[model samples]
Structures are given as C-alpha cells and as structure tokens.
Target chain A: MIDKEQVHRVAHLARLELQPEEETQFEGQLNSILEYFEQLSELNTEDVAPTTRAIDVSNITRIDQLKSSPNREEILDCAPEREGDFFRVPKIMGEG
Target chain B: MVSIRDLHQQLINKDRSAIEIAQEALQRTKELEPKLRSFLRLTEEHALAQAKQVDAKISAGEDIGLLAGIPIGIKDNMCTQGIPTTCGSKILENFIPPFESTVTGRLAESGAVMVGKTNLDEFAMGSSTENSAYQVTANPWDLDRVPGGSSGGSAAAVAGGQCVVSLGSDTGGSIRQPAGLCGVVGLKPTYGLVSRYGLVAYASSLDQIGPFSRSVEDTAILLGAIAGYDPQDSTSLKVDVPDYTQYLKPDLKGVKVGVITETFGEGLDDEVKGVVETAIAQLKELGAEIQEISCPRFRYGLPTYYIIAPSEASANLARYDGVKYGFRKPDSNNLINMYTQTRAEGFGAEVKRRIMIGTYALSAGYYDAYYLKAQKVRTLIKQDFEAAFESVDVLVCPTSPTTAFKAGEKTDDPLSMYLSDLMTIPVNLAGLPGLSLPCGFDQKGLPIGLQIIGNVLREDQVLHTAYAYEQATQWHEKQPSL
Candidate 1:
C-alpha cells in the first residue's frame, strides 16, 4: 500500500494541492488501482515493442508556408492577467 | 420531426423555414432541459443565426448540403468560437476558443445548427455524468438513472428530442456507452477518420469525434457532414470519405459476425447478457454468420486503458497551469503556488485523481513498471483483435455490462463505474470503428446497447449490419415515457 507521504509527493509532482483528507483518500484509491494495475507487470513482454499509436503514420508535414494566425485579441481576452500585447504572470527567473 | 431526410426535403420544398424548426426545438429544450439537464449552455442566438443563414441560402435557391439547419447538440469538449467549451471542468469554465474544431467547422460548412453545448464527465474521464462538475444529465428514459457518459448529454439530447443529432468524442466508450443507455445510435468512427484539430485533448491517440442520432440514416448523414480529411489535424486520414448514407441499407447477407467470448462471461449483468444474446440471434437471422471468437487479451483492456489514458491526460492537461487562460486562484504566494492552487481548486475530483495516477505511472521509478508495460499490453490486446478480425467482417458484443444505474450508484466506487465501459474499450484500444444502437431492454425497461465493432476503416460494414438489425428490431422506435 502507498503511504500518505507518497501521495503527497505525487500530488506535488502533479501540481495539485490536496487537503489532509483528500491525501488519505487518494492513498487508498491509488493503491487499489495501482494494485489492480500490477497485473500488467505479470504479462510476458520480453520482445514486444511499445505501441504508442494505433494508426501507423509519422512525419506528416504541411508545406512550409505561413498561414494567418487566428484572431489574437479574441484568444488573449480569456487571460486572467495581461499587459500590452503580452500575458502577465507571477515573476519568473527575475525577482519581483 | 424524427427523420432528417423528411426534414431536409421539407426544408428544400419551402414547406417549413429553418427558424420555425429552430424555435420549436428551442421551445422543446426550454421545457425538457429542466428535467433532462442535457445542456451546459444553449446557443440560442448562434443557433437562430445559423438557421437564418440556411433560410437565406434556401431562398436564394443555392443548394444547402446535408444536415442543413438540423439542430445538433455538441459535447462541451469541442471548441466553438466565442462559446464555452468547458469539458465539464471548472478549469476551462469560461475559456471560449478563438477558433472552431475541425469537426464543427465541417458541420458549419454543411449548414447544421449548433443548438447547445452538452454536459459530460470531467475532461471525458468518467463513465457516468455524475463526474461532471456542472450538472448530472439524467437519462430521458428514467430520470433517476444516469444517461451513461461522458457523452451522456449528447445522447440525452438526441433521445429527448431536443435535437435531431449530436456530436460526441469517444476516448474509451464516451460516445457508444451513453448512446446505448439512452437508446440512440452512436458511432465512434475509426481513429483517424475524424479529425481532432480543436478538440480539448483528453487522451490524444484514443480520442475520436463521432455522431449520436435517433436513427442509422440520420447518423450516416451527420457522419458524412462532419467527416473528411482535414490538414489542420496531423492524424486526420487522407483516405477517401465515403458517402456513409449509401451504406444505410438493411442488408448484411454476406457479413461474418464474431461474438466476443470475453464480453459474455462473469461480471456481465444477466439482463444485459440476455439482451446481447438476443441481439446476436437477431443478427444471425438477418443473414449474418455468427461465430464465437476469443480475444485472450481483452480482459486486460480496462486496466491498460486506465494507465494509457491518464498518462496521456497528465501530459495533455499539464498545459492548464493557470498561466494565460481559464481559472486562477486569487490567493497564492508564487507562480508555482498559483498553479497548484488553481488546478487543485479548478479541476474536479476525478480529473485530479486521474492526473495523480498518470503522474505516478509516468513518474521516474515506476515508468517501466506501469506506463511502458501497459503500452506493451496494449499491443497484445490490439494483436488479439487483429486475429479476431481475420475471420469476421464485424464483431458483435454488448455496449455496457448493465443498463443506466441509479445516479449516485457507482460514483463513490470509481472502479465499478469504470466497468461500465468494459465491452467498448477494446475498440478504442485497437483504434477500430464501433457503432452502438438500441438492441433491447432490461427488466426495468432501460435500453441495452448492442455494440458492433469493425476492423480499422470498416465503418461501412459496421453501419450496414447495424442498419439491418435496427430495421429488423422495433427497439429504436420506442421513446422514453418522459
């Protein structure tokens, strides 16, 4: 069974903040589901390559021509914070 | 009102105006939506505007293509320019897109009306609509039961007569399961057959947009309108887009139907199993040669899907860092704190759980033990399907193990809710085309779905066989007593 510490670690890694009760509940649920998933490790996969996509296609490229972008104002309108033609955010790299 | 063909003919003959139909559908939605709760946002202005455009085209004597002025419900996950596409989560609650999805774009070019944005499981993660952070879509057949989701609202809108057809995305039985429970026709076309350009990504490779409709012919017409190659989506197939309506004939004389053995065994409810068995016999009666086939790796599908979908979801949903769009928690010390709080507060429980599981599966030490192994097993499951298809033109099975359960019955136990898609997940795993139509009813009169799966790109055969069975049976004609 997974411990609360591990659950907290995973929640942090997933960028989610969980309360004490949620962490406990997650530990139980995750352990049960992960236990259910242990069955996959038992399968013989010695020579099988991983199948990432069901369809066989790759390197699909369009012509190297520029297309007009979508209405930028409409998209930028959804931003929570923004400056002149730029998305505003909490300080990054440099201190506020 | 039931037939898209008759509606289209009337529309062409000037017997009825698109505004008249749109107003009636709007009124019908106004009355039933309180009980059904199938929609997240009804696009009354947009739908009426599009109806006016169709009316203008008809008045000008210009030919409007298929699905002209047909009122259709769209799943909330598909982006509509300036319309809310929330994916049933608060994170994207107010995030309207600047552009349209390829499927909806195609629909608009074909002249269909966008009636509303339908409800769904959060980010298409759960089997029941209870996972929706907004509202639980009730099954029109039995208001106390779920419509079966994450396309529950799409199915309910079609079943409740609020729309003639609807579009839903299937990442695991999202379209087919709800359609089965709601007694409508839902088709998850072959993976690349439908483009996913502007769809809010759930699990990229497993996802495909398809149709939910009252009849097979309506489904075909809607499928034709929304399907075709789109350069916008990298995975969109370049194959010829067949006029699917041509395949709607009730003829399956030379078809070979394989009954999946894994679908019938333990865990399948007796009533559902009995309905599936009867549907199989009825198919045999319609000139389909039935054979019992084994897919040894089929049982592994549920676990494998749980791993792969969440793993992909973790990657896809990582973009929601509360940076540019959507919700942002006000109280946060730093950027990282803002991300954690925004996501933790914004996303629903199921979405967060899947994100956590995915993060754990794809985490450093466990990568080899979980994600990679699940992908390898996915191949084995695919191979099992490939072998089954070598002898059969189409595979027949139940869409769900049971009818729509009581609203909160499986919500607490996520595993039990996950089991609802048992019979339908293998199709997604294999990237095959699958169609589910009303086959029979359980003891309580809830509809049972008969799943017809075809090999990759063999949707014609799947539709042909379903059309035959649907024509043979009286099941699809029965409306909910609502």
Candidate 2:
C-alpha cells in the first residue's frame, strides 16, 4: 500500500492542497487502484517501443501565417484578478 | 426524437418556422430539465436569434443546408464564444470563452441552433454525470439511474428528446459508455479525423469529438458537417471527407464481424451479455459472418488508459493555475499559496485524485515503471487489435458491462466506475473509430448498447454494419417515458 507521506508528496507535486480527511481517504483509494495496476507487470515487454501516438504520424507542420486574434480586453476580462491590461496575481520570488 | 432529415423537410416546406421549432425545443427542455438536469445553461435568446436567421435565409430562398433550424446541445467542454464553457468544474465555471471550437463553429455555419450547453463530469474525468460539480444529470429512462458520463448529459439530452442531436468527446469511452446507457446512437470518429482544436483536453492523444443522435442516419449527417481537415488543429487528418450517409447499407453482406471474447467474460452482467450475443446473432442473420476472436492483451487497456490519460490530463490541466482565467483564491499572501488554495478550492475530488495519480506515475524514478510501461503496453494492445482486424472487417462487443446503475452506486468506488468503460477503452487506445447503438434492454428495461468497432479510419464500415443491424431491429424506437 502507498503510505500517507507518499500521497502528501504526490499531491504537493500536483499543486493541490489536500485536507486532512481527504489525505487519509485517498491513501486507501489510491492504494487499491495502484494494486489493480500491478496486473500489467506480469507481461514481458522487452524490445517493445512506447507508443505516444497510436497511428504513427508526427511532427506535422503548417506554414507560418498571421491570423486574426481574440480581442485582448475580452481575453483578460476572464481573469479573476487583473490589472489595467494584465492579469493580477500575488507576488512571486519573495517570501510572504 | 425526429431525424434531422425530417426536421430539414419541415423547415423547407414551411410547416414550422425556425423560431417556432426553437421555442418548442425550449419548451420541451423546461418541462424535462428538473428531471434530467441535462443542461448547465440554456441559451434561449441565442437559439431563437439563430433560428430567426435561418428563417430569414429560407424566406429569401437561400440554401441553409440539412441542419438548418435544428436545435442541438453542445457538450460544455467544447467552447462557444460568449457562452460559459465550464467543463462542469468550479475552476472553469465562469469561463466565458472568447472563441468557438471548430466543431461548434462548423455546426453554427450549417445553421444548427445551439439550445444550450450540456453538463459533464468535471474535466471529463468520471464515468457518471454525478461527478459534475453543478448538477447530476439523470437517465431519461429512469430518474434514479445515471446517464453514463462524462458525456452523460449529451447522451441524456438526446435520449430525453431534448434535442435532435448533440456533440460529445470520447477519450476512453466518455461518449460511447453514456450513449450505451442512455439508449442513443453515439459515434467516436477516428482520432484526429475530427479536429480537437476547441476541446478542453483530458488526454490530447486520445480525445475525439463526435455526435449523439436518435438514428444512425442522423449520426452520419451530423458527423459529416463537422469533419474535415482543420489548419488550427495540427493533428487533424488531411484525408478526404466522404458523405458518410451514402455508406449506410441496409445489409452487411459478406462482412466479417469479430466478437471479442475477452470483453464478454468475468464481471459482465448476464443480461448485458445475453443482449450483446443476441445482437451479434442478428448481425449474422443480416448476412454478416461472425467470428469469435481473441486479443489476449486486451484486458490491460483499463490500466494503460488510467496511466496514460491521467498523465496527459495532469500536463493539460496544469494551465489552470489561478492565473489568466478560471477560479482563484480570494485571500492568499503569496503566489504559491494562491496557486495551491485556488486549485484546492476549485477542483473536484475525482479531478484531484487523477492529478495525484498522474503526478505519482510521472514522478522522478517512477516514470519508467508506470507511465512509460503503460505506453509500451498501449503499443502491445494496438498490435493485438491489428492482429485481430486482419481476419475481421469489424468487431462487436458490449458497450458497458451493465446498464445504467443508480446515481450513487458507483460514486463511492472509483475502480468500479472505471469498469463501466472497460470494454470501450481499448478502442480509444488504438485510436480507432467506434459506434454504439441501442441493441436491447435489461430486465429492469434499462438500455443495453451494442458496440461496433472498426479499424483506424474504417468508420464507414462500422456505420454500415450498425445501420444494417439497426434497420433489422426495433430497439431505436424505444424512448424513455420522461
């Protein structure tokens, strides 16, 4: 079973803040789910290549071209906290 | 629900004005919304105005195409300019997208009226619509039961006769599972066949947007309107788009249909299995040859999807960090605190759980063991499908192990909820096309779906086979008494 400490660390890395109750609840749920995944390990996968795309075509490119864009004011209007023309946020690179 | 062709004929004959049709649709929605809760936001004014525009065009003797004046639901994840595209999550609850998704944009151009945005699981994460942060959409067949999700609302809307047709995205059976449960025709076109430019990504590599309709013919009509190469979507295929309706052969003569053995055994409901087997037999009577085939590695699809989908979701959803758009914390001293608090307050439990799983799988020293291994298994599963398809033109299976369950039955157990898509996930993994249509009903009268799966880009064959079987059965005529 995955331990509580490991759950906390994974949640932190995912940028989520789990409540105490949620942390404990997830500890059990994630463990069982993880255990189910162990069934896949029984197969030998030597010399097999990973498939990122099912149909193999990749690196598709289009010529560089200019196109009309959404209005900037409308785009910034959805921001929760915004300055005159910029999205507002708490200061970074310094301790609170 | 009436077919799109009938609606078009009605409009052309001036039997009903577009405005009249739109009002009737809204009226029907109001009468049923309390029971189904299919829509998150109803675009009454927008729908009426668009209908009026179609009416004006027809009055001027202009061609407005097949979808003209038809009211339909757009799954909330697909963007609609000025409409709130929440993805059924608190994080995007207030996000009024400034642009239209390619699918909806094409539909609008075809003169289809947008009646509203349908509900879905938060970020399309869960198997049931109960995961929606706003409201749980109920199956029209039985109010106590779920409309299978994350496209549950879309499926429910069509099944409830709220709309002629609707759009839904399928990544690991989001569209097909719900379609199976709700007793509607749902199609997931080959990956990259329909552009994913405006779909809010759960798993970019797996997601494909398609339609839900009461008839397979309508499914073809709607799919044709939105499919084609899009410069905006880098992965959009450059292949020729055919009039899929022409491929609707009434008989599947000399067609080779494979019945997947792995999907039938263990944990599947006896009634569902019986219904699927009978449906396969019906296909044989329709002049198709049926073969029982084995894809030995097929059972691993569920685990592979769990890893690959979440890993991609973690990266795609990372953009919502309480910044440019979406919900944010009101009180936080620093940026780090704000990010954490906003995400904590905004995301639902299932979304958070997936993010954590993805993070764990992709973390340092574990990437090779989980995420990479899942991808390699994905390769094996794809090869298994390729090997099976060599002898069969198409494969058929049960869309879900059981019919729609009670709303809260599987909510407590995520793994059980994941099983609802077990038979459909491998199709997504292989990036193939699949169609789910009503085949029969369980003892309680809930709908059972028969899935017809085709090789990559072979949707035409899949549709033709489904059409033949559909013509031979009366299942599609059964509607929930809402």
Give the i-RMS of model 1 in Å.
2.2
CA lDDT, every model vs. true structure: 0.90, 0.93
Interface Cα RMSD, each model: 2.2, 1.2
Error of 1 at A4 (Å): 1.1
Q: Taking the tens digit of each residue's C-alpha lDDT, what string does model 2 give over A26-74? A: 9999998899899889878878999998876678886788977757788
* Model 1 lDDT, residue B115, Cα: 89
Residues B1-482, candidate 1: write the lDDT tens digits: 36898889889999999999888888999899999999999999999999999999999999987689889999999999888889998999879888999888888878899889999999998888888999999999999999999999999999999999999999999999999999999999999999999999999989999999989989888887778788888988898989987887776788999999988999899999988898898888888899999998898999999999999999999999887899888757678878888999999989999999999999999889889998999999999999999999999889999899999998778788888888889889889999999998988989999999999999889889989998999998999977
Best by TM-score: 2
- Candidate 2 lDDT tens digits, B325-383: 99998878888888889999999999998998898899998899899999999999999
List the pairs of residues colliding in candidate 2. Answer: none
* Over 4 Å off, model 2: A66-68, A93-96
Looking at model 2 chain A, report the run of 10 residues with the lowest lDDT sum.
A54-63
Q: What lDDT does candidate 1 reach at residue B284?
A: 86
TM-score of 1: 0.98
